[model samples]
Target: MNRRRFLRSVSALTALTAVEFAPWQTMSAFAREVEDFVRGPAVKDHPLRRISPHVWMIHSPDGFPTPENQGMMCNVTFVDTAKGLVVVDSGASVQIGEMAIRQIRKTLKKPVVAIINSHYHGDHWLGNDAFAAAYPGIPIYAHAGTIREISGMQGNLWRTLMEQWTNQATVGTRVVPPNTAVDHGQELKFGDVTLRIHHYGKAHTPSDICVEVVEDKLTCVGDVAMDRRIANMDEGSYVGTLAAYAALEKNAGSTIWLPGHGLPSGQVLQWNRELFEGIYQPCEKAIKDGLSMEEAKALVLKDPRVASRAKDTKGFDSNIGKYVSLAYLEAEAAAF
Candidate 1:
């Protein structure tokens, strides 16, 4: 099947599912519209935005993926240290990464000392080539498993489908491996700055790391605490996600939190903790109750807190649903 046809079929199925099972009749109309928009042609470019001093937010503008079909957005952070600039998580594509590099060079002439991949996700690491090409021999850091995961995957049906559904161009398949790997907790020193890398295993991915810049009191939490919505767990464990969020809350010091996406929040640590406890926990509970995926989705829909965020919640459902499904799948696996 071709990409366009497959996307159209997926969009149709999503609309049908929403119409059939969505409890609120009012939601069906909006859901159908969202589904169509997601399967439509891609937008031109997602311009980068500077959210804080030495911190920029690289949004996909395409948004996150959903069952009804929506684009995915990833966050990248650029930190200016005394030694050189350190970038946290490259954007979705090489172009986006190049665009971000251009923005970084506008202010700072220091070479990119390092590139950190928060996890193994393509959105975070696919742009490594762009940066690597620009700054030759700059060290790239990631967890050991992350390097393995990216290197192991082969271009196949999934990649083709993703390109079609997300409107991403078909770039060559070249794996970007990390030179440095962090275990549980490792401290990296850059000039007078100290970045503590903490591995919160299997949260958003098998090899997620939260980078804390000690001198700046800034934490570039890759995807642990997304500002716009819940963290994506398509390839993670719910127990791990909970543990990771708890770890982030427990260890996140009184400092500015720079999430991979969304605005930096002063109360990010606490707000993210609350977001998990208030939103995800209940969704997990609903799944545990043997609610069908559709039913579980309805439960999330009813929550005013989740619903309030649902206004901008087109592509977010897929990530949330994936998390819910993973939680249930993990429970099932544990039962066996």
Candidate 2:
């Protein structure tokens, strides 16, 4: 998760969830040290798993970006389009992205025709520099809002944080924002494969767009449906996220869902839906019942499942408070 964005978004609620200090901030120095040691050249075998004849993905080990993983914590996907390859969500840094390209070359020796940015998150797009260098003039696709988010200092913010997190491993990783912007239902066909790009309003982020491969019967649902980690929804909408999951489920009949994180499965869409709704309803009720923010926070905090589930899963513990706060704000905004 982007720690800076998370801090900025919920800065107002710091006093409310003051039990935990700035955990991410406290680890910066240690993270830099780790990154310095582990930030090296890309490897050829980085756990690339095949889904079908044309679809394959690399599930970055679960947890925060570290030198050990070379900041390759986001799931990077590549679709073999026969003539060439199409990549979805580049790795977190230049090295990680380069690693993906090298790994892909092991089996599929096709040029990357196009690179798609699933969202504006730096982890998803910062690696664009690697692709642009390897495949010159390749068109990078994303939603207009995604372009806007990564255009200004936001991209730099991601880079700076990543440099610190990866011990300056991303020194040459410049931001190459998407050049082409696709609409809600734009379809692009390449070598007998047709990808239907979809923007389900504002779910995971304001600019999230999932890619559905028509022939492969697969949908790459960005951060809309993370596998086990508790997703950061500070820039997302509770209602819109629920609706997005519902829409994804409605269309996902036997279609494999390759999420931005974790393994690919059609089941996680419903899992994420239940997770969102499970937290949302209580918060909404707390709001409707005129309970204080502390009461709502306490309600979620007191729940044994919320605490237990977060503790059992990696990367989910530190984010529960943030998700509850965001859900509360989303519920309040929807009410007005």
Which parts of model 2 are misplaced by more than 4 Å?
1-44, 252-254, 301-308
Clashing pairs in 2: none
Clash pairs, candidate 1, are 63-71
Candidate 1 yields a Cα-based lDDT of 0.65
Per residue, candidate 2 scores C-alpha lDDT tens digits across 246-320 of: 776666443688888888876777667666776787789888988866678788766654654555556665677
How does residue 10 of candidate 2 score in lDDT?
60
Q: Estimate each model's TM-score.
A: 0.73, 0.84
lDDT of each: 0.65, 0.78
Lowest lDDT 10-residue stretch of candidate 2: 31-40
- In every candidate, how many clashes are there? 1, 0
